[model samples]
Target: MRILIAEDDPSIAAGVSASLRQGGHAVDAVTDGAKADAALRDTPYDLLILDLGLPNLDGADVLQRLRKRGTGLPVLVITAREGLRERVRVLDLGADDYLVKPFALAEFEARVRALLRRYTSQGAPELTIGRLRLDLPGHRAWIDDKPLELTAREFGLLEALAARPDRVTSRAQLVEALCSWDEELTDNGLDIAIYRLRRKLADSGTQVRTIRGLGYLLEEVKEGKESEA
Candidate 1:
């Protein structure tokens, strides 16, 4: 999962970023509403953690603008305000969830998981393709009920591919899924990740096939074919 944190507090932003990264998500932090809005406009993210006290354009205004622009991106508003009106205002302005300040890290993480599950999986916890299974919340994958060990990038690649099994996913789309604005992913970087993922899935009866001038596809191994080239 990719997330953008729009917070003016350096400490809170850093802490949230670390926690999200540790939880196997790519994260980017912006300290002001202007930058936050620009980041949202420029990148694709699974969620946004926004603070209402942001500078250079209040966070509520940012949310309003985003909604006006027809972006249905899931937003979790973090604010110190405890008033019902404030909460209702943000919710009415299109924030999907709200967290008051001084929240426990555990609770925050749980809320994040809940929101992601609601939006991304629509209540489904696992994705299955033949003998392969991806545990979305657990950040784990399995083949024939055996655990599959994979690096973070490789797991992300697999998740993207498994989301649409057998359909060709372009290299550009894969790169967007694997990288944030701060991280640069070249064609070679993507190729290396694909090669490593293919090797890891070699014995799982699942194959990641290159589509020549296109990108790649993930599919169950065909009968009589020992491997994918």
Candidate 2:
């Protein structure tokens, strides 16, 4: 998943970003609400970790604007406010969930997982494509019950492809999925990752097909011949 963390505190932002990345998510961190809003507008993120007390535009206002746009992007607000009214106000303004400051990392991650599950896959943690099985939570992939040693980027690429098996996933979308603002993936980089991923999945009864000028597709391996599509 690609996530944007809008937080002013460097320590908290770094910690949360690290944890999420460790969980196989691409994350971008911003220190102010204006930058956060800009990033939100420019990028397509699976989730947003927003801090209510922001510099230029407050978190509540940000949430309100996002909702006003009818985006329906799942937003998890983080605030130091413990008042019930404040919580309700943000919820009313379209914050999907809230977490008070000084919270446990485990709990924070759990909340993130819950939100993602609810919004992305209806609580399902595994995605299967023929003999290929991707354990979303565990960040692992397997073929015929044997595990494939995939790098983080490789796993992310596989997940993106497997999300819509046999459908064309454009290079732009794949680059977005594998990169954050801090890390940029060039066309060559994406190609290398795809090549490595294909090699790993060669015998897994699945194939990553390049669609010439289009993009890539994950499909069931043909028995005797390759597919031109």
Candidate 3:
């Protein structure tokens, strides 16, 4: 999943970003309210970690504008404002979840997973098609109960493809999912990753079918249906 951490404190942002990256997520860390707002407007993030004490714009205003834009992007407000009423205000302001400072990274990661599942996975931790099972939070996949080893980028691509099944997911969307805002993913890298993924799923019931100029899709390999590049 791709996530944004809108935190001003450099150390805190680094800690949180490292944790999410270790969990196989692409994370973008921004230090100000204005930057956060700009990022929210441009990037498609799976989850947001926001701090209320942001400079230039403030977290509450950011949340308000986000909702006003009619985007259902899941927001997890991480702030030091510990009053119960404060929590209520943020929640009412459209924050999906809130966490106080001095919280455990483990708890934070868990909350992130919960919010991602709630908004993106329909509250399901896993996605299945035929004999393939993808543990979304764990970033592990299995075919016929055997593990499918995947790098972070590979898992990301597989997740994107799995979401639509037989429907095409555009190359641009796939690139956004696999690369961070700062990184560049060339066509060669995308093709290499897709090739390796195909080799991994060769014996499985499902396969990644490329749609030439359009994009790629994951679908069950039928007996007589030919797959195109």
Q: Which predicted model would earn the best TM-score?
A: 3
Tens digits of per-residue lDDT, candidate 2, 103-173, equal 99999998998887777645577777768887764577899889989988999998888777658999998
Question: Per-prediction TM-score, please?
Answer: 0.89, 0.89, 0.92
Q: List, in order, the clash count of every candidate structure.
A: 0, 0, 0
After superposition, candidate 1 runs with Cα above 4 Å error: 186-188
Candidate 2 stretches with Cα past 4 Å from truth are 122-124, 226-229
Candidate 3: regions farther than 4 A off: 224-229
- lDDT string, candidate 3, 126-197, tens digits: 888756789877788999889999888889999888877668999988888887767888989998999988
RMSD of each: 2.0, 2.4, 1.9
Q: All models: lDDT?
A: 0.86, 0.86, 0.87
Worst lDDT run of 10 residues, candidate 3, spans: 220-229
| Cα lDDT, model 1, residue 225 | 79
Q: List the candidate numbers ranked by lDDT, top first.
A: 3, 2, 1
The collision pairs in model 1 are: none
Window of ten residues with lowest summed lDDT in model 2: 220-229
